[model samples]
Target: MSDVNQASQTLLDSNPASQRIPPSVFLLTGAVAVIGSNSLVLSPIAPEVAQSLGVSVPMVMSGTAAFGLGTAASALFLARHIDRIGAWRMLRIAFMLLTASLLVSAAAPVAFVLVAAQLGAGVAAGVALPAIYASAAAIAPPGRESKTVGIVLTGWTLSLVAGVSISAVLADWLDWRAVYGAVFLLAAGAFAVLVFNGHRDKVSTEPAALPLAALTIVGVRPLLLACGAFMTAFYGVYAYLGDHLHSVLGLPISANGLVTLVYGLGFGAAAFLDSLEKRVSPRLGLPAAFLAVALVYLLMAMENGTYGAILALAFLWGLANHLGLNLLIVRLTALEPGRRGAIMGLNSAVTYLAVFAGPLGFGWLYTTAGFGALAGLAVVLMVVAILAAYAAPSTPRN
Candidate 1:
């Protein structure tokens, strides 16, 4: 049997009555889906939101920026508490906060109100995401860490597939308010599940590391730098892909949606490859994944003129990204188990900081130069990630 399958058999032999996958993992996955969906749902319905709030589309997009800003701030400052307070408790609090924020967003009277609500949700997500990752790592059976993390990360695929698609339909049929309302229901449902079924962690007596202290941990700084580069490249390209398709390629919005669907499909497909990482050391596997991303960006830069090439590259981009992301999380979570909440919080902080900064920097490049120049910059960023991953300290296997 493959390592993953054998690990499953081991888990099964240990607990005959239990499902191969634990209920808690699924619950954690649901929580991740809630946060992921909230992050991405704004783009497809931006026009509807703008029209409803009587604001320009740029003003509506500022809500997304506000959300990113809030997340970055909270992740840096507040996520350290997850270790001290316990991951499960932090997650429950996040769910409550998310539910309340979504409700406020659904009922908001103006664009500013909507932005404020999204900012609140972003704060909740900052802590919620690190707690979710820490919880997933904590609950993983021996030798199943990669498979388990891959499964929880699939929540992003859920967001890409169901979240954005459904929000668009709801906006078209009901109104933009229904989109937030639906997310509110999902958040509330996940909160209910955690309240009833989730296990409580014994609060640690160990004080959580401050953000600066977290950087002192072995491998953290380079890993976080890699993470920032990886995310910046992704967000930079993603921010303009649809516009590139629409204005340059003259493809309809539906076609752009299809491209996103293809990317999501590719992301989901990469989950099957996660088990393969068990056989290879992450030191080798991570750099290879990062190199794959670098290659994809290079191809995108060279082939920016072709629709078919762009579509195919998008799939490869998603696939490489999934592998890179999985390895990054696994390594970070392994580095200092007791301090995972703090480390992963740094991960989210850098990621959201990239979310705020990537587009702005890439936008200037794209406007002054071109898509080719923008993608070329992404390639350079991926190169930085590859080098940082190569130089980082090794992680213990779970």
Candidate 2:
């Protein structure tokens, strides 16, 4: 019995997030928060960065595409190696690259230099996030995997606020470069903590080539498509939301910020979905969330004038998006426990590629058919996503 208890404790210690909000988990999430915020930093401070680099706002805005491109490319090629390199080791290397990239941005001589730096930083994010997410979920308590994943994901939603508001204030006081500089410090600190933690991760025994070939498997392919569709639909409007609200919904510029804050908080509410996941399999829960998101997008498209309705739907979209993204990740991990890194890389690849498409497609629709049509497109894509999610494999709770 004593031997049994010792064996059990060892098992728990090796499990992902089994210890409940460990400092390592919090630090990992905090590091991701900084990474997430830095990814969006250029958006809010495009004008400042442009002015500093002697370029037009449009020229600086193209950095967004560069970032996405870098992330997509890395997800396809580099992120698949996380299993071999190990998450903790990969995280440290990623921060090294990220810190270097930020410093380059801080001292960039021209717009071209800034763009390159952004691309490099995006590559680091692509490498780090998949590893961090998979590691977080793997270490979670038996039934709390989804919740642990959600806790880590809170960084992304929080970035909407931290990336925009904090950078804006800092830019006003000390040029946009200051924002990147501060991020470098935060990332470096996160790296330092990991170095001292003395934790050694177990290397995966999966074949090196397995991650690249995962796209054809029954377990991963459909979920990846579902994720792609869902992200494209959600970000389509989300990317242009502030501008859409100001132009389509007639909300004042001053109030748009507040509205986004509400949406971010709503997205964070996805953490609670663990309860629902515990009751229902993630496969079923995922499709249900997709249907709900479809409804929200459709409503947002049809009703342009009702301020209350707009706010409600935006918030709901955040909530549902949270559930959808987490479940998809969890399902992918469960589907191929050995290929967590690879599947996550594929997931990230799909998301970044779709993110690039969403802005362009929705922007064009908003320009031509108006907000209603853009929302219609979102609804259409979500219908496809619902089918895709339904096709994914289901694993009942333990």
Candidate 3:
């Protein structure tokens, strides 16, 4: 059997139907909730945290940057270790570390301590995300990989929507620390579910190593550049959406949450649409989504405090961003099945590097050129992604 066949067989053999819950269902659901909750729950509380810690808001926001930086820093090294340690084991460790980090963050008495806690969470996420994606690919029936990834990734959308709405309410009713405490509790619950399920499977002992040169040689250079550009634009908008809504439209914090929730809803909707690759080719659907995002940026640029208009643009942006991300993942996995871990690691590193840089870059752009200019830049980037999508080699069906 070929390496792909052998890998797929190993995945299926280890988790007999009688002994396992479908890996896709369990991992996707848990990962969505776990990863989403971290950012969604914490973003609304940044100001409150700064006040409580007697620091500037910018200082409190450093935690977010630290998280992104930590994720970027650890991605390559962690990818090397995932198969050696077993994907499931790495996931468990990630969850435990995330839980501990949340608890530490909640209890932190100083801004620096909270930033450190978030950094730990970011590193844990770096390990967890690639492992989750690789396992999804390994365990999913061939042809269902994109759908599985979409479902798992939808957790992010749900978290963005639900986490922010719920956290906003929690922040209003109680202290920001209370919000972090709730997130810690949720992480604890997710950790337990993963642990209980994972314990049932005998760990794979095979050395699943890939040649570094193979990873370098695959047609990955364009894909990595595409991932970075897409994420930089996607995250640049997301990082400042709340601030932009408040500053530009004079909307209240509660209103900002509602706008973000709408965006999240769009993201969740894309999970369903992502399955359309079965009906429409990814080559077609992917570029269509990118085009939709470009249009949304245009709408955003044109908006002048019209709530309905903003809501509609936000929704489209969310859906398009996620659809593009899922397509990229599918493309990468198809390009090099054996090196999914390394490719995904490179993908993750590029992605978070964009995330880390987007906010700062956008802040400068927003100050110098205003929202219209920033939106124009976003449109230009999406156009570039569209061109890249068209240029990518189509995956042959199995």
RMSD of each: 4.4, 3.7, 4.2
Tens-digit lDDT track of model 3 for 1-398: 99999998878766556334355466556675777677545555555566678986446666777787777776766765676666778888888999999999889989899989988988888888887787777666555677777777788886777677677667657877877888888889888888887443234455645534334644577667667777777766666666566667766557666777888898888877744666777567667777888888878777885878888887888888788878788877788676667667777777777767776677678666767777877788888877777777667543
Candidate 1 regions exceeding 4 Å error are: 1-19, 47-58, 171-174, 304-307
TM-score of each: 0.89, 0.85, 0.87
- In order, what lDDT does every prediction score? 0.83, 0.75, 0.73
Q: Rank the candidates by lDDT, best first.
A: 1, 2, 3
Q: Which run of 10 residues does model 2 get worst, by summed lDDT?
A: 251-260
What lDDT tens digits, residue by residue, belong to model 2 across residues 148-171? Answer: 778888887777566555665677
* Candidate 3 TM-score, true structure as reference: 0.87
* Residue 32, candidate 2: C-alpha displacement in angstroms: 2.2
Best by lDDT: 1
Which scores higher on lDDT, 1 or 3?
1
Error of model 3, residue 3, in angstroms = 20
In angstroms, give how far residue 336 of model 1 lies from its true place: 1.1
